[model samples]
Target: MDPFDSSDDSDDDIFFRMMYHYYTTDLLQPDPTSLLTRCAMLNRNREEGHKHLYRDYFADNCVYGAKDFKRRFRLSRDVFLRIANALESRYKFFQLRYDARDRREFTTLQKCAAAIRLMAMGESPDTMDDYMRMSERTARESLYTLSRGVVEAFGDVYLRKPSSHALQELYVVHEERHGFPGMIGSIYCTH
Candidate 1:
């Protein structure tokens, strides 16, 4: 076991041997057919879900009014519509489409609603399946797509860095509101 002896296997050789053994013998490789097996598709009736959502929130004489919409979504219905519309116009993913079987997919509002629900309520993707008639994967995709869409669509105005005057105003406002002079934000510790 001498360090400089060229007789024994080197550390790299030992590591590669271990890796090769693990891959060849220890690892349980999955079957290609098993990889092709998918979950059973459920007829969640996405069209019906769309109609219900429209009747409850967007349609005239709908079940829920503007106040209810605002309370639930943390944004006024008009503002939500504006964002949804902007995203739909900007991102093709937000547009309604038909599947290969000619089955209508979820509407733009449904996808946006799933994304907003995830943001507003801090819910997981599975929670949207029952309400939005979308699969968990779809709900997760909607969240990501909506986030990217919003940043691309409205990042210039909403996510821009503040000007010097704006920062000064924010500092003054923070001081007046919290009685902490010149405190704009927490550095590390978050409440």
Candidate 2:
């Protein structure tokens, strides 16, 4: 991918926004300014009426378009819901698998967790975006789930770790790659 082909104007822009929180999550690398990157993707000369939300309201927080509020992009909760539902169907996601009683309440954060597990292991974002039937930003935001409410859902009370323990293997690999024991993941260790 050229990475500059925003011409399709497909709103990968919104999905890309999740890189903002993705990098910042789980003590992972910082995905702090993806919103700014998205801002830069907008073709000011080609598109009109796009009001840059992060730049306008979060000037101090964002660096890419701190001064320029010309472009606008935001992924709403509803968009995330449809994408999440679609992915659930394809993946045959059973809320029972996650130990949740009501599958209808599956939120974006839950969906994002799936995408993160999928992409972080080397799955291409393009493929994932297609599989999830949503833009890349949707993939990221669904995983991001920045709110404490969503993060809480990831805890032991809301969802049990899958018996397959794939994350456990990934944790071991993380430790092996880092030449340390801590990175494997806190779940496997007391620390």
Candidate 3:
């Protein structure tokens, strides 16, 4: 019968309890932004990105050939696909997935390409949005994920120091290619 008493299942008492809880908990919490600004979910057409990438580099009858792919990406398409496939298999993040809104996320190719473009072109993360249709944050994350994946997957094969014999062979090859008998690095002319 009392308006303030929570013992009875009354609307007024319930409101009071909610207000008290809100003041004690949520009200005390600091607001991150002074302005009532919230980030809106951008509709970056990820599917188109994937499709364009595929058409340009991955498809059987892709617009670009192996030479162009290598020229633009700084690697052969075969090697790129190998790295991408490896990352997708090893990392859950690289795998195709759906968001809470049931929207399909970026494909493995898109993510890998984003990362590779950033590395190869030395471009900013936001630059990928124009062609890749991914947000800057996503592009940045993709770069990091791809780097870690490549290091983990192909570290031993590609990242390890050259063995004595391998080093000797490399010296020979460099000498042959550049006509420099004992060139260790990319010094063109020491004259």
lDDT of 2 by residue, 79-99 (tens): 334444445544433122422
| Residue 1 lDDT, candidate 2, scale 0-100 | 43
Clashing pairs in model 3, backbone N/Cα/C closer than 3 A:
none
- What clash count goes with each model? 0, 12, 0
Cα lDDT computed for each candidate against the true fold: 0.86, 0.43, 0.87
**Per-candidate TM-score against the hidden true structure:** 0.71, 0.23, 0.76
Among all candidates shown, the one with the greatest TM-score? 3
Q: What clash count does candidate 2 reach?
A: 12
Question: In model 1, what is the error at residue 67, expressed in angstroms?
Answer: 2.2
* Model 2 misplacement above 4 A: 1-120, 146-150, 154-191
| TM accuracy, model 2 | 0.23
Q: Candidate 3 regions off by >4 Å?
A: 1-38, 185-191
The local lDDT score (0 to 100) that residue 17 gets in candidate 1 is 71
lDDT of 3: 0.87
Ranking by lDDT: 3, 1, 2
- RMSD (Cα, Å) of candidate 3? 14.9
